[model samples]
Target: MLTRLLACTIAFAAPLAALAQTPPQVSPAVEASAPLEARIGELAQILAGKGDYDAYFAPAFRSQIPKEKFAQINAQIAATAGPMIRIESITPRTPWVADVTIGFRDAIGTVRISVAATEPHQVDGLLFSGLTPRVADMGSVRAAIAALPGRTGFALARLADGAPQMLLADHGDTPLAIGSAFKLVILAELVRAVNAGERRWGDMVTLDGGPLPGGQYMNVPAGTKVTLRELAQKMISISDNSATDILLKHLGRDRVEAMLAVVGIADPKGMTPFPGTLEIFKLKGVPGLADRYLALDPAGRRQFLDGEVARTPIAAISPTLFRDGKPVRIEQLEWFATPTDLIRVMDWLRRNSAAGPGAEVRAILGLNPGIPQPAAAKWKWAGYKGGSEPGVMHMTLLLEGKDGSWYALSSSWNNPAAPVEDVRFAGLVGRAAELAAPQP
Candidate 1:
């Protein structure tokens, strides 16, 4: 659910009638201010439509953001929440800064807009807050899933019962490619190993120069020593590919598979010898490799993967392969897990939370909260992990509400023809989360 779109500027818009109820912080002087109010209103209309507002931006803002960048940001907003419907209210925070409440087709939120007090009145800053969209009821949530551009599967289940109360299942039980989200499974295995005394949290391991290229620790030279716990932190918090591969190498693939079995993952054979980021790149970079590999039966595919891993050196992989090479057929090259299987993983983590390693794992997962949720403070704790590659997107969350209720929301979307819309999909997930626990 964490995406680049969250960083986009969100401004305020409100109906004129609603301005009377606006916070008293705005003096009558500011409300009656002729040109500034009109200009801000004009800015909102320009943003809602496709009009360019480069002339209205402060010199610093214009220099910091290019025209193309603004276009992309506007396009993302339009795709996710539709055009701004109206401004709900505007509260002046300072002579130059004000908070605006804006309504969108699917959501209502507040944004702080700051304008320089100058002749042209250029906008200097914009920030969003409390932008909670209306939660779709169960039926609407299902309809939305069915309306996605590609195949989609989702489940909302309480961790207490481990059963999906609401589900939009288009082959929901079948495992699909889930990119770095596979690291959750590895983290689970690592926690189990630590709990069993097979490995110590502080145990030091020397990097074999096998760390992959997609994340932090990539710059750490070969043979550098670091603690197992620190490596696990990087692996989950940042989806660090290098940290993951190093841990995978340390633990051996068999143990990871065993952990899957131990946790009762619905389909164990569907993912065996879990391919590290490097291995995935090696197969994906070669033309027709994924198709050929996937065409084989499961055993044959596993054998082929093993053979490829044995032959390929981590150093030989071009760092630019994932960025510049053809998009890998994610349906074949990445991790596979059904929504139910992921729910089971969440259940395991919750049931085991009192254990030392369990607590540690949850702590690490909580390190990155993923997308921001409205009324997040109402939850005792929340942990999230998401994964994406061209044509594949997945997100899973474990939350414990203040009322002692536990819930898990796991969803995935796939389209082999194009990249999934990150912002729109994230909004859907946010709606689903809100439905799971409504604000008091």
Candidate 2:
């Protein structure tokens, strides 16, 4: 639960498309004047793999974004999305600003362009601001998720003041290995503490011990002072394990565990004496330790963690344990949660984060939204935290959809024999978000 993000959502990483994708038969309908038409044609050419990058775009724009780079991005998107199939709409905001909705075989996006007034009207500002997969219906969303390898659990629910209303779910109640997504609980406890006036967000924490060094912190010194705000942000946004451990230690294990009920975890005792990332690493990384720890009751396990696990030097752990690139004692050693638990935790976050000290929680979760644009844009706010390790992957989203409709989608995929496919899972959540949201 304490590791940094293993993989970012693919949409935010880069444009994606499939070779199997083929252009659909449809014609463009240009409601605006010729300026948009010309811009759309050039953009289509790029996606269609026929554009001369240097001659078409403005000199200033090309200077910043090289022809080869743009060409490659277009090629990748085209390869997956196929050629531009249709123009959904074109709206002019000003003489120079306009939005163009372009559709591809499997995806659709709105690119906003800024055109220059001079001859050739060589476009100046161009960006595919948001792109979302085109799912025919909820069946496509479910099928995409079910097609993945290993055990999978997913839940999509509408959240508004009361308990979450499930829209669609597959194996939503089953408990599975949820990696860093467990950080949500840690964040929730921190929010609770800050809200109750037990602690202040601006409190300074000095680094007595940090799992890894980031070349040092805050430009002051190695173990320098950092704010709770900074730690909370890093812990959630980047899933920073070091920050997580620090906050967990600062918050007290019992205090943090107490909030588990507040967040609606069904079996709080299952995760009793919650272990930090370093603790989990030591339990699994140290030879002959997992079995020893697994044999104990919660009290015995907590004692073992504080005693032998804490005393063992980091050097004593075998590097090869993690080097094999396979799941290592994941089912027995890692953090645990169910899809419903994740949604409930997220719902608590959404409801509490509306004001007070919890407000920053919203911004922190939105820091690395995990959702790509257009789909991300559909929601007023998109807060996300994803987790992964060999044989384990999880994604949790808190979305504020149109008309003040709020929702959460959480999923977990675990396969001990091999690495779970993260990109496919990312696409599943993306399509689910598109389907969950009220269409424009």
**Which whole-number lDDT from 0 to 100 does residue 310 have in model 2?**
80
Structural similarity to truth (TM-score) of each candidate: 0.73, 0.72
For residue 97, what is the lDDT in candidate 1?
Answer: 71
Question: Which tens-of-lDDT digit does each residue in 42-120 have in candidate 2?
Answer: 7777666577776678899886567776776575456446678888877675555566778888777666676777778
Give candidate 1 misplaced runs (Cα > 4 Å). 1-70, 85-103, 108-132, 161-171, 295-303, 313-327, 438-440
Best by lDDT: 2
Q: How close is candidate 2 to the true structure, as a TM-score?
A: 0.72
Global CA lDDT computed for model 2: 0.72
User: Model 1: which residue pairs collide?
Assistant: 13-86, 13-87, 13-88, 14-87, 14-88, 15-87
Residue 332 of model 2: what lDDT? Answer: 83
Clashes within 3 Å, all models in order? 6, 4
Worst lDDT 10-window in candidate 2: 15-24
Clashing pairs in 2: 17-80, 17-81, 18-79, 18-80
RMSD of 1: 8.2
